[model samples]
Target: MSMQLNYNWLLVLLSYAVSVLGSFTALQLAVAIPLAATQRQKTAAVVMAGGAMGLGAIWAMHFIAMLACDNGMDVSYDASLTALSALVAFAACVAGLMLVGSGRFDWLRLLAAGICMGLGVAAMHYIGMAAMMMPAKISYASGLVALSVVIAMVASTVALWLAFNLRGPLQMIGSALVMGVAVCGMHYTGMAAASFEDNGGQLPDGYAEGLRGGNLGLTIFVVVTILLVLMLVLHYWRQRYRSSISI
Candidate 1:
């Protein structure tokens, strides 16, 4: 009995690990490639396409895990749901672009890159988490192992992308910051999406809550003000310096 129990536990651990890792890898593909796209748009597009396909791959892997563990995973919906989710995710990406563009940050270019990456991560997490359901009949623990793997893979990919693509100290720092935001966004979104639907979780609801919180709007206004002031000061200073050199 003892030996049998240990063998069963081992299978559980291994299966959990594999599924989580695959999911995390899916997240990485979503986040890193979008940020990298700013530098290599064509290459980035290819990466994005790969990421879309990866969704299916990860889902298949998760299904396999469920089968192995007798957890009973099924997708009762059609591919249209997947496509709809992808469209929603892309809309989030466009919103990120608009937000970054509206604010005049000291590092606007870098900020845009980071925001896009972060949004991608967030979209991937929530979308992936919302993709399936656990049968009320099967008493299996949530695949947190799979979720962790997805996050770690994403972080590592972002780090690698930054190391290879970003140049200059400031740019590197900006890229890192962006990737960090992406990771955080991804985690929260994934958690939210994975939560029980009846447990009061909706993406639009979260967005509205953030906006009504006032903090976000104030923070954006303050940053924009600071950036404007800095730009004015820099312009005058540059002119003075040039005038002196000419004289």
Candidate 2:
């Protein structure tokens, strides 16, 4: 028998929304990274902001997308692995931000930063997949995985370039939209790369057995919404303070 993957379209749409919101916030933070008054402040801001972006954009988006997936089997996740995957995502985002925001705008640096960011995003995806504790063994197509990584790298490079080069609200909005599409594209492509084999194994204890797709989606939605609001408030406050100081 052939295995089929089913997805809840509603949840998939919600995942995309989460991605967009995360990308927008990340872009805003990226733009602000270079504007810090001091080197220490810039580094700290980049790490914190990058972690927040990774949490919402990469980690949360991946989780929500997984929630949308159904392989006609009972699926749960290893709590520790899941949490660790988020940390990995945050670290990757921080590395990417640091590389791009390092006060140097060169092709080599951009390429290096893009590759690092791409690999980080891809690593987060695969790691999160590993966290799934289902009664099956998971595998991947090598080609699709490579393609997804390429998409992530290219998109990440573009996003970083836009973050560094673009000015004003309209440009930022456009960059966010494009970056969101890139993030979603990489995710779905990675999903396409995955296949499961029934191993007749049992799910382990202490996994995320109680969480369902809808419930997880609702939780992510609420969390991301709150984060977005907080980010906006911080951005505006920072802007106002900077304006006052410049006078």
Candidate 3:
């Protein structure tokens, strides 16, 4: 029989909040890339934006959502895979942001970047799911899996376009809202694609040693706190930049 899966609604809301905040910070960081006067400045912007999107928005939100899941079974995650998944997400966001942030914007670059990010996000989610060490086997519905990927690509492209093309308050809030949709949509859809079947208590090796929910909770808290700081810093920096140019 499949486990009776449920969720902590508060955590689900928090997951979305984290996604939005990460998206907001990343989108704001990316908007400044075009105005960067040198290669070094552009590179710095890309890295910061990528980190905000990948680590804060995608990776951290994923773990929070995972922790929110109440599967009625004790679960742990493989340390290496968990780390690898974050790396993949970070690298992908960096590459994608770099591609679109540099040079003149075009459909081709947008498409390519979207595909890269979309695949990366999907890959991270699946890889994270694989990190689970529990007494159950998980399978996915092929169609829903594919649908989730499509949503990731489309939403990412739209968000990036909004960030690059728009100005004023709309740019930051709009792009971030869409990006939040991209992250949250892909996550929950991928989760919906999953079906967990009960196993004969054949837990994975080292399950006892794997990272547990309590560990992840603390990590998520730290990530959220850092994200908040980044947002404040970004806002302060933007204000300074605007004042300098206005004078």
Candidate 4:
């Protein structure tokens, strides 16, 4: 039997919102990574920026997307696994930045960084999927799964390139849009790969009821909003300091 899937349009829209926000934040961090590498004192800042991108963009986007999915079965999540998935996403972002932003730009480095970042994203997705404590057996279509990985790797590579090369506000905005699409594409495609089977069983102990889609969406909105504000403040402060030093 064909697997049935239902999506809440509102949640789906929210997922897109998170994607865009995350993409912009990531691009900002990508631009900062190389600059930070030039100054050892900024190393900690780079990591913080990377963590923000990973947590806000990659991990949050995935979580919101997952909440958008409905399979007509009782579903919840394991709290610990859910939290761990965020850490995985953060680590992936930091690794990607460190690899590509080491002040040694090269094709090989780009490729390796892209692969690592892509795989990191895929790992976070699957890990988050595993966090779902539903009474259904989940399976994936091998072909779609492979396609999703390819998309993630290629998109990540291109995004990193743009971050390193692009300049000006318009270029940044354009890059962010492209990256947002790529991130969302990888996510929904991965979602397409998933197929669920109801096993007629109950969730195991320690499984907390999942947040309602609406609730999750609202929470993500608040979190992303706060992060964006912080990013803007940091950006402004950095620019101001640079201006002062130039004088």
lDDT score, residue 112, model 2? 90
lDDT of 4 at 5: 90
Ranking by TM-score: 2, 3, 4, 1
Q: How high is the lDDT of residue 194 in model 2?
A: 88
- For model 1, the local distance difference test gives 0.37
- Residues 62-167, candidate 4, lDDT per residue (tens digit)? 8887887888866777777888888888888778778887768998998998899889888888898988887778899999999999998897788777767876
Give the clash total for candidate 1.
4
Better of 1 and 4 by TM-score: 4
RMSD of each: 17.8, 1.8, 2.0, 2.0
Question: Model 3, 49-152: lDDT tens per residue?
Answer: 88888888888889889988878889999999999999998998898888988779999999999899888988999999999999999999999999999987
What lDDT does the true structure give each of the candidates?
Answer: 0.37, 0.81, 0.84, 0.77
The C-alpha TM-scores of every prediction are: 0.31, 0.93, 0.92, 0.92
Per-residue error for 83 in candidate 2, Å, reads 1.1
TM-score of 1: 0.31
Which has the better lDDT: candidate 1, or candidate 4?
4
Q: After superposition, how far is residue 123 of candidate 2 from its true place, in Å?
A: 0.5
Candidate 3's displacement at residue 22, Å, is 0.4
| TM-score of model number 3 | 0.92
Instruction: Please list the residue runs of candidate 2 whose C-alpha ends up more than 4 Å from where it truly belongs after superposition.
Output: 205-213
lDDT of 1 by residue, 1-247 (tens): 0011011234333333333333233333333333442546534533442332232222222222222222122222223444455454444333333343233423545444444544454444444444443322112124653564356345534533443354454664455355444444334324332322222222332232221221322333334334434533553575489679979
Instruction: Give candidate 2's error at residue 222 in angstroms.
Output: 1.2
**Models ranked on lDDT:** 3, 2, 4, 1
